[model samples]
Target chain A: MIDHMSALFTLGNMQFLLRGAGMTLLLTMIGCTAGLFGGFLLAYARGSKGTLTAPLRWGATAFVEIFRRIPFLVTLFLVLYTAQMIVPRAPLFWVAVVSICLLCSAYMAEIVRSGMESVPAPQIEAAEVMNFSRWRITWMIVLPQAWKVILPSAVSYMVMFVKDTALASQAGVFELMFAGKALANRGLDPFLVFATVLFAYFVISWPLARFGRWLEAQLARRTHEGDRR
Target chain B: MAHLDISGLEVRYGTVPVLSGIDLAVERGELVGLVGPSGSGKSTLLRALVGLVPPAAGRVVLEGKDVDYASKASLRGLRDHAAIVFQQYNLFQNMSVLDNITVTPVKVRGRPKAEAEAEARALLARVGLAGKERAYPDQLSGGQQQRVAIARALALKPALILLDEVTAALDPELVRDVLDVIKDLAGEGITMLLVSHEMGFIREAAHRVVMMDAGRVVEVGPPSQIFDAPTEERTRAFMSKIIRH
Candidate 1:
């Protein structure tokens, strides 16, 4: 066991593992950043009132709910086939990216939505009587206050997406897990390969979790201390 | 003609009536004090005026113009001329004191930011919160926040100001600070409808007091008459209960 583990820690193996880790990091970065923006749009569309936005509300609601219920692995294949059908020759990486975006946006929208709704009704009423347009009220009063609630959850979600992107490996998108599997198929000990994969995941996710906690602390202080600007 | 008149104002949440047929009027620059037991719809009345509650039925004539609640333009026109100060002083938590007072004026009213900000500072001074513009709402005491809210309402230059228990949420020691600001505004000849539980403050500041019970006005008279010599049994009974506390 010692000889096998010792052989697994090669410079070439480390480089290969790092490359796979880089792909996982890329998916998380693209998914979280793009998903955050898409999530807000979804949340806003869902939360909008008035008869005219009724259809938009329904469409956004259905998208968040339906996409959230489907498993990530299933979505990877679903998007894999669907994207291939649409573009006929779309790259697997782009197809994987689309699946991660869809999965992350649905979950992130709910995080953002609950944050938006967390504002007391009276706060919105205060704006209403001030003659603020609903859009202005949302942007100025609601969103600024909502960031405190949204940030911690959003960062944690990014950490979660780090692991979630491993699901992309099933579709041959090349990430940490896929590298581990390939190394194992090449006759390396499976335990050692997966152990490296798990360590790489921890390296990527630990900082994000710590950052989330730090952000939560800052928000609490800002809220209580009334930090200027 | 009165500067503001609300006749047959009706508000309901589905089948439950919050305010039914509330008829009241205030002369130009007159302060009308609204006193009532809990759940008597005093706040609801204030909410309805600014188009928050959407009165189920009513004719609200303001400054000789009729307000049609069903018409967006009309409701907007009404809000353009009226503002409300809440008991909890619901200042936008994210904004500095100056921004809270100036946001509507600068953004919604399309006034120049510098001009509106200057006016906000002046209003803040009038409310006795000078040199606190950079502070956020959580930094202020209840009385200070409520005064900030009053300043925010005053920034609108509204023809009518509805103060719904503006001091109700204040610490007892802080109540006098907000009351002092309100008394000064009343002296400036601004029309106001004030809902409060502080009978002593209302009696001293209000031009006339209107007592509400069960979503209806039970009595209307000067403070002396309402507090010392109420005619209706309901007003007398409610006042006795409130004053004892």
Candidate 2:
């Protein structure tokens, strides 16, 4: 039984949570930025019509399956603990960052692969006739269209990225969830503190999910209108 | 010299053969139309011509030089001379119409940006899309998009251009606008190989018509002969259906 009252204006607590929220945002932005680039490389390598394509696909698949199967908590524990042994006084924050990036990239790679494949075959043909190199064709043509086509899904992935950052608090990196836990333990009213934390997450993530849905609708409307025209 | 010549061309998708034992030639500045019902290898043949679909067993000679697909350098040399327009307009959808037309010339052809934009603007004007320089593909109509494709192809000043059913996707009313652009392009002396279902355009615009059926050329002659007085039974049957429909 959690009371959803009085925690909003708790000045010291709100500031602490806000600071943690900042760290959470930082973690997601860094992780997703790295994940986007990494995922693209994996997706492109896997999908290319080259001899190395199969091997690269297999390697990426293995990485995804292994990471996705192992519990995130265990993975973080191993990475944080092992990394600390190798280099004491190193930033444990990096371990959390790397873990989130690796997990998100595995999923984002599949999203990007779908985007790449959706580009019409003729588009590449047109590029070839214009004497465009593979690199030029990729950067100048394929990637731009794909970025647009995959945007809604990518935004959803960003939302997932933000939610995933909360898990990093287990690595002792102080973020929103950790901040909430600290506040709850200090106060006698655990339910009030936790309910406020839940509300705070909704405030952050609901907008992202709503924005993604709105974007998807906007794109669909344009496509339907184009067809009608 | 012949602009493009293919001898014993063959293409396959996995174990399924799409084009086999195909032979064709196009002289400089020739306008040739390839017509066939669906799945007649017309598109496959056009793809083969531009090295998009490499032959399983044959040589494509461009200006008397055999296209060696085994060598990247040779293929790059071959690509410089040809441009392709697709059945589905393959405009880079994220870019403005002007960028779609000028990107290859500026980036791939290594022309200065100002020079490429100048040439691209002239091409857009030639295609009657003079004011659509900043419109995105989705903002334009299908006919407009197809014209952008034509302008993009022409921007390269290619020795040979392959148009694969460029108007297949347009509305019936919009079809003529695109074909009219192609007709105007021919008047400018650009060598073009077209695969189209627009029989009227073939009859009026083509200098020569090549009819393909079941992965082979069933007829090759002047459009009048192919359309009005076909000698082959298969050709007559095809024409009869079009006329009846």
Candidate 3:
């Protein structure tokens, strides 16, 4: 039996994997923050009415569709290879993080657009009639409600977002999966190392999954109470 | 001076005209009830007053200033002059009842938070929501939510207040509480333009009644005159239909 007992005591290799876990968390955090911002711009472009709206909407939609259609690994390759040629001097960490953000932003934009659509037209009309400035209405009214309505789904997406960060290993980003492969190369039992990697993924994903479920229950309760009233 | 003057008003959603060639006016301190069946341009008219609907061709003059030409800065300034309560009770869901009332005052008007919140609390108390200041809109009952909406509008202390079917969404039993608040506002001589289907409230509170049909003012007169002796057959027909039920 491959012993987790032995692996736990292997201090030197464990330190390397722990360091990689730190990198993984950092990549997920940076990628998600950038993705969320880019998604907001995409959603607003899709929502607005103007001559450029059609083209902008099309571009944003296509960007999302293309990334979503391709496998995450392939998208990572395209991002890394193109970026390395364009800006060879930039750090590999940035290249990996930026690629993940670009890929994830498309899905985030769709989620946000759906949330925005769920907001009532009258709420927006109320803001306008009150003569609220565009920025004030968005920040004060629209986005707050949208965020509440979509928060559960967003939490669920974060689990996927974190798992997807593992794909950054393909770009030589030295994340958790990359660390496991390095340990395997040094004659560590491959099954034990990969199992540990799987366990780590479970640890990250499980609490987040439970939190998402709790959020959904809370939202449902509030909506039910709203209807009852 | 007329508080509101709308002339040659035309509104459309794409190619379909919802309201066309509409002209209306309300003098200061007049409580005007805009009565009409659903889709009769009553909501459309209310929306146009504050530039929510872009009128295809019209002039909306408020206090001798053309509202159409007003910039965004001037528009927010005008919000302090006129506040609105929607039928849906479109309160900010994320904010407490007090914050809902105080946001425009503090954020939009640049009033200090403490002072704005103080004004908000007083208005909430006036509307029978004193203890519910910290409750979010979703936490309040529908009637309470609508009252908070009224308090929020009142916090602005505008010269004119537009209420578009404010009690339409409330339970039948809860409707009276909201109407009572409106009655009190009218008694206070606050200039209010109300769009509502509650005939009894209209008769009791409105200084003038303007009945609209097919996007035109079918009749405009004292409530006694319109209710007792409507001039137009269409007005008489509408009254009979509503009163029969």
Winning model by lDDT: 1
Error of 1 at B163 (Å): 0.5
Candidate 3 stretches greater than 4 Å from native = A1-26, A41-70, A89-91, A113-124, A142-146, A176-200, A214-229, B187-189
TM-score of chain B, candidates 1 onward in order: 0.97, 0.96, 0.95
DockQ of 3: 0.43
Off by over 4 Å in 1: A223-229
Ordering by DockQ: 1, 2, 3
Q: How close is candidate 2 to the true structure, as a TM-score?
A: 0.85
Ranking by lDDT: 1, 2, 3
User: Candidate 1 lDDT (Cα, whole model)?
Assistant: 0.88
DockQ by candidate, in order: 0.56, 0.45, 0.43
Q: What are the TM-scores, per candidate, against the unseen true structure?
A: 0.94, 0.85, 0.84
Give the alpha carbon lDDT tens digit for every residue of B1-245 in model 3. 57788788888899998888888888887889999788899988887767677678888777787775335655665666888889884887767788788887787679899999888888888988889887788788899999998988888888889999999998999899999898888856467899999999899889999999878888899999778899899889999999899
Winner on TM-score between 1 and 3 is: 1
Candidate 2 vs candidate 3, DockQ winner: 2
lDDT head-to-head 1 vs 2, winner: 1
lDDT of 2 at A36: 80
Which candidate's DockQ is highest?
1
Q: Which stretches of candidate 2 lie over 4 Å from their true place?
A: A1-22, A52-54, A64-70, A81-85, A88-91, A115-121, A169-173, A179-189, A210-229, B187-189
- TM-score of model 3 (CA atoms): 0.84
lDDT, candidate 2, B1-245, per-residue tens: 57778778888888888887888877778899998788999998988777777778887898778888767788888778878888784887767889888887788778899999998999899888998898888888999999999888888888888899889888898898899988887856678899998898999999999989988888899999999998899999998998998
